[model samples]
Target: MAERADAARNRQAILQAADKLLRDHEPGHISLDQVAATAGVGKGTVFRRFGSRTGLFQELLAERAARLGAAVESGPPPLGPGGPPGQRLLAFVDELALLAAQNIRLIAAHERACGADPHSDPTYQRWHRHLRGLLSELRPDADADFLAHIVLGGYNGELVRRITASGGVPRLRIAVRDLAQRVGDVD
Candidate 1:
């Protein structure tokens, strides 16, 4: 069923409020009450809509990844469907590195929220599937499933943040791309 107009409005308000708060404050420091107050909504509404802090962060991460998901599903070459597997692997890693670099706080928050089971998250599962498919195509002899997770290990948000803090996104991107190429290259 379609969301009620007022519900949609409130959701947007809550999300906007959360986004604004996240930009200035650490996620651990932000609270539902604060978000509700910032959005001019009630605390119960925030709780009802988001369930919990982890759920809210998950939604935010999903929103951030949606465009990349769409591009990988159907947009254009490299990041999309038309490029060769190696080029697409490079592009995918490049974009993910950039996203992780740019959204360090959000990624960090989500990582903390997810704790030990990030593989269960939908956005991550989608990206993992895509990477696995590309790797399988590029390396029929390798264990594509294991290799996909390995590639993703390097893209872990906390790791990405640490790497970017020192060497920057450019260096991170190059390293990840090189990793993808090395792992996916046929022997």
Candidate 2:
């Protein structure tokens, strides 16, 4: 039990350090040595815990996705359960766009390292299902699944990065709001 607790503590430290580093610098620019130093752990500990940089990225993605899912499941506001379907959907898109803007560098690095399609990822699938369910509530006769896919395209990391780089986060949020409005009108 002590060993397990120690392992958990080490894992949390590593994750916290990596998350801080990723927030300060792009994932591609971060090294495991830096993570280990920040976490106050040996380099071998990071390797033993995560296997590789790609594994570390995957874990980070999963953690972020889980947090987002929890917010949508039980948190307050338009992104949660209290709002009208249209408002909730729009809020969801806006939130997703912000998250994509914040994490695009890490996400892009994960994609490059794993060569996995973001759309097919389990986390993305959950988001798609949530959107589809909301769309179905608004327009039962329409193709909610396809519409969800289309709506999610606006929140893609690459698109968010380009828009924000060219303009800013506010511009990207405006674009996302525009897309959400159009999507919400698909009844």
Best by TM-score: 1
Q: For candidate 2, lDDT tens digit of each residue in 50-107?
A: 9977777778777877767887899786788787888888778777877778788777
Could you list the CA RMSD of all candidates, in the order they appear?
1.8, 3.1
TM-score of each: 0.92, 0.77
Q: lDDT for each of the candidates? A: 0.87, 0.81
Best by lDDT: 1
Cα-lDDT of candidate 1: 0.87
Assess the local accuracy of residue 142 in candidate 2 as a C-alpha lDDT between 0 and 100.
82
Which regions of candidate 1 deviate over 4 angstroms?
A: none
TM-score of 2: 0.77
**Which segments of candidate 2 are over 4 A away from where they belong?**
1-3, 23-25, 29-48, 51-54, 65-67
Q: Write the per-residue lDDT of candidate 1 for residues 67-161, one digit (tens) a residue.
A: 88988989899789989888888889889888888888888778778887988888788889999999999988889999999998997777887
In model 1, the Cα lDDT at residue 110 comes to 81
